[model samples]
Target: MNVFVSEVRQLIDRHLPHYVQSLQAEPRLKEAMCYSLEAGGKRVRPLLLMAVLEAYGKPISIGLEAACAIEMVHTYSLIHDDLPAMDDDDYRRGQLTNHKMYDEATAILAGDALLTHSFGLIADAETTEMTAEIKVALISIFSKAIGAPGMVGGQLADMLAEKKSLTVDELAHIHRRKTGDLLTFSIVAGAYIAGVNKEDRLCLEQFGQELGLVFQIKDDILDVESDSETLGKPVGSDETNYKSTYPGLLGLDGAKKMLSYHHEQAKGYLHKLGLSDTILGEIADYLVERLH
Candidate 1:
């Protein structure tokens, strides 16, 4: 593993434990919040942001607050997603999901708290060296990404499509907004804080979008081909929910082909960025190779 990856992982692990403890609540509610927040997963999104910063020669200190904020937003989404009203999943990361482990109201509140707390985390980060304009822009980008026009909108679209056949375009739109927006934000956020120029930022944004799409498509394919033990959630849940995905719409072989094409496209964009970094190459490879 890359040293940066290990360090970033440790940073997240260390901060998350204490961060969860700061969730002021009644004892039982506190436990419920801690349960899901502590659940293990790949931490791909936040790590991607941190890696982008490292690749651009920014100190981890500059990106630490943004990295944790990304995770907080991600965890909040997962909590709400597993609720009965959303994906209705009973398990996540190979354990009982928030709603399954706690009452529905507690799960809902926990998700809400995490989402609302993310902004405070960002605002409180010591950003003395960062210009006020840049910090405000970053906050705006993240806020919009998590709001109705972004993840929440995509989720609503997904819910509307459940049990009903959807066109390939529809599936792409949903996942692009649901997953791609935040993933794009990761790259853009890192690049912005690193002071990359506008043209390079545009290229990186495109790269991140393609990467995020590939990530989601591969996930759908794995849902069809991998067992629950590897996936950390029920395999075929998309099919179980009758939700549309790349695999559900295009067949396994077709989805794999799409993934390969997008993976290569993402690499092509990365090459255009002119940055020399082992982490970027390793990340691209890992995105294609990861089983979960």
Candidate 2:
């Protein structure tokens, strides 16, 4: 799994810059796009997509464009998420955030460009080896996952929930859309590319949902347990924003237990799929164990 992750990361690192460079727009916009895209992070979404592809005995290259597209959307979200009007953080991935490094307007535009460009990348006829039918399917999946009914809706719910106490169910609802939808898209996108049976695709989608819950739970735990330097962003931002989190709603230990439960659930679904490889299981473990 480590080897697979390393390979995907390397491919993403190369492809992201080249894709951005291919754009013939404003130089500053391009610069801001590259800046945020190149900023180091876990690259988890794309890796998950590729891992699923690898698991199904498909070439990782088949999913690379869609994987990169998902990363772009993820990166765009982070850029906007750190704006002065949003999370308002000064740092991300161990460096100044897009809005902090460039002006807020540039950051906003850069994020918008990335978001729209992601769709273009996925739709480009020459970009990937996938059939037009599959490309359209992926675009639909990608759109729904990040659009108003998905991540955007989740973000709004989260913002509205700030400073307000939320029940466990409410919090779960927010995380499922905000974080889980995109993660689920990542897995299911690869499953679609592999032309897996409907049953396997459903199992992978279920696994993705559980994996996303585990991700958010661990993230909440990390905010309280880790430092800003370790997290590469302000720790306790959730608290500062008066946002409800698993750790705040449940004790730290309780959050850990919840995380463990979701982790097991995710692995269970993965096992049910009965893939020939173990990358997806390893990815589930990595998501729970990751510190930042």
Taking all chains together, each candidate's TM-score versus the true structure is: 0.95, 0.97
Model 1 per-residue lDDT tens digits across residues 1-292? 4676778888887886576677676777667766876798577777787777777877767877777888888888999988997788888888999988888999999888878777777777786645678778889999888788889898898888788888887888889889889989988888888888899989989989899888899889889999988888788887877778898788889999999999988988888886534486578778889888
Q: Candidate 2 on 97-213: residue-level lDDT in tens?
A: 999999999999999999999999888736344789889888988889998989999998998888899999999999999999999999999898888888889889998999889
lDDT of each: 0.82, 0.89
Model 1, residue 36: displacement in angstroms? 1.6
Error of 1 at 29 (Å): 3.6
Per-candidate clashes come to 0, 0
Model 1 local distance difference test score: 0.82
Error of 2 at 126 (Å): 4.1
**Cα RMSD, model 2:** 1.4
Report clash pairs, candidate 1: none
- Please give the RMSD of candidate 1 to the true structure: 1.6
Off by over 4 Å in 1: none
List ranges where model 2 is wrong by over 4 Å: 125-129
